[model samples]
Target chain A: MDLINSVTFKDLKAPLFIAWQINSECNLGCLHCCEEAGHPMPDQMHKDQIFNFLRQIIELKIPYVALSGGEPLLHPQFFEICEFLRQFNISLKVETNGEFIDRNLAKIFARLKFRSVQISLDGATKDTHERLRLRGDWNKTVSACKALIEEKVNTEIVFVPTKFNIHEIGELIDLAYSLGVWGVYTGKIMRIGRAAKNWDILCPSDEEYDVFFAVLNKKIAQYDGRMKVYYYPYDVIEELKYRLRYPSASLLVIPNGKVKLIGPLPFICGDLRKHSLIQVWENYKQAWSNPKVVEFAKKVIEEPWLVSEANDWIELYH
Target chain B: MVFTAHTKIREEKFGAVIFETLKEKIFITNRTGKDILNLLQKGSTLEEIVDTLVNSYSAPITNIRNDVTNFINQLKDNSILTR
Candidate 1:
């Protein structure tokens, strides 16, 4: 696709990736899952809808597409969808919890040939992990991680920082490296979805989350590029240090798509169903001067009431 | 197209980005004497970009269009646009 000559939102060259959440239904009901599994699935975008949607993505020539779900592996047409999307020359990333993996699935994963696979892990030990995941299978996750490693597939383990598991951050990092995995990425539990429902248990206060990142940073520094780590908000001292020392490994992507500038804010960039992608980007450009949206984003960072709530417990660790 | 070598156009800020795609240039300014320049991309139009922001942010249609018109003129006077 030829590059569009017009620059609307801050001279954007183009979008490089799009994170598509096809379905929100998942088998495991993890205590920390943001997608909260029991809701009815939204109507699946029909083939034509998907085709039309994909045409916009193709026009941008985004090199990567990360397909996520309550558990994306559960989609009945999982493989077929992969084959179809493969036609567009996009590298794929399948995000899953790993309970669904097996030899047959591994073979398919290897064959379908995604760019990478990421399995979510809350803790390094079975007891700690099972505690947060409720009925989750830690052994299965470990087995799946090993299988992907053996296959020489690019695999990552995503750890969501919560009150219960934040104390053992070092062990999780060591566990990932010991298994010969590519790297580990930890995200702060934003107050949304099922995570919001269990806020008392999941959100460990901003202070605690900061301490958790600090401890993980100490351990992470020892490896020094053998493995990589990324965190959200990009405000942590550790992350700033890491970026200064080795800038190439970290990156951030807008989950819905980077089509508009008004993204990365509290308000959504309207429904893509009713408008063309170009139209979406254009409107986002005009929204930059929106006083309300700008004010909201500022308050989240400046006030961050959530930070105060987590500060007391966080001091102990830091 | 109008031209002024050192015209300064007011730039607007977006979510976490800014509307600075139009580099400094010379162009025609509307009656309000605002230069509207460098807004068009290969498949984009001034109206289309304004419409997208309006839809995404749920802004009032009338106000956004009005601001866009002023912005367009500002750019035009700066000679930042080809058309």
Candidate 2:
């Protein structure tokens, strides 16, 4: 079944996962850490703060939330927070590096009932993987993937294609299948965070990604339902026009109760806490219809400075 | 301070633009005036507004100044301007 149907860009459902980094501390410093890894642990969110935010999210009736961190698992009360959030009838999507998803952790993951778990693996082989992740244990990450699948959790392998691992993307897809992940998401390398700092080494040129996603679609076609695929920025490629048409079928509730109008715009158009979901939607309608805002968006898409700001938080976690 | 909202209008010549914070919605008639209206807003001085239009739009400030002064007068004559 093709996940993407004959929908135009206007029809796609809004995004469901409002991805936010609750903390910036990570145990492993990957070479391409978008948020620029290896920073000291940030002031962890107090339990009350997170719970309060989740309550606001529940009040807003948003359907999903994703908590990321340098390593969200590293948070002292990570599991407790997850358990606390389960009462709200909201699906949780966890984007983790998988260094912490061992047997004991797998039990916790199962209990949380995460709708989906996305683990990052840059290369299909250990040699290439270790090189990109820097002190990353490929075997351990693979083991974690196997554990999640065995537990029957919907799992996705996220491959951030950089110059280092661009060539081995085909092999990585095979690796994802071997582990029985529900899908694999090979994302483009954005030149915003550390990728910007190490542009020469990390950012893949247009020619490189052309071959990467080409092979990816070919693999998707070959495997059929054994796996599914999704991309970031859901690029405006002609072949992918069908995917854009689906009204972004997702809604993101940030820690501060901000309902991002679209996937992580540089500016917050309205706060869900201060306004109802319908109110927020109205503001977006107003903002969209406003010529000034529309012009600004056109400029943002055409210019790098504004786009870089919206993606700045990605660099902080990298 | 409950501010009055004008009818939202657009002009293609000056590109996509929204002129708010003026008297009850005035439909900007000329493309040149639309270019000036893009920068005119609350708390903006005639001088500051003229400066932005002159530097950014690159249409002589004197020409824009006269247009803006006339637009403000028209709105005032229509009882749209408070101050």
lDDT of 1 by residue, A174-198 (tens): 9998998777888676554566568
Give candidate 2's error at residue A244 in angstroms. Answer: 12
| Top of the candidates by DockQ | 1
Local distance difference test values of all predictions, in order: 0.58, 0.61
Q: List candidate 2 stretches off by more than 4 Å.
A: A1-17, A37-45, A231-233, A236-265, A269-293, A311-318, B1-83
**DockQ value for model 2:** 0.01
Q: Which stretches of candidate 1 lie over 4 Å from their true place?
A: A1-9, A205-211, A233-266, A302-318, B1-83
lDDT of 2 by residue, A1-318 (tens): 011123321321222234656666677878777666555433444666666656655554444567776677777767776786666545677888898898777877877777678899888899998998887889989999998888887788899888899999889988888889888886666544565567678878899988987897888787786677656554322212322233343344444445443442444556544555555544544444455545545665566445445543221010
Cand. 2 Cα-lDDT: 0.61
Candidate 2: give the TM-score of chain A: 0.77
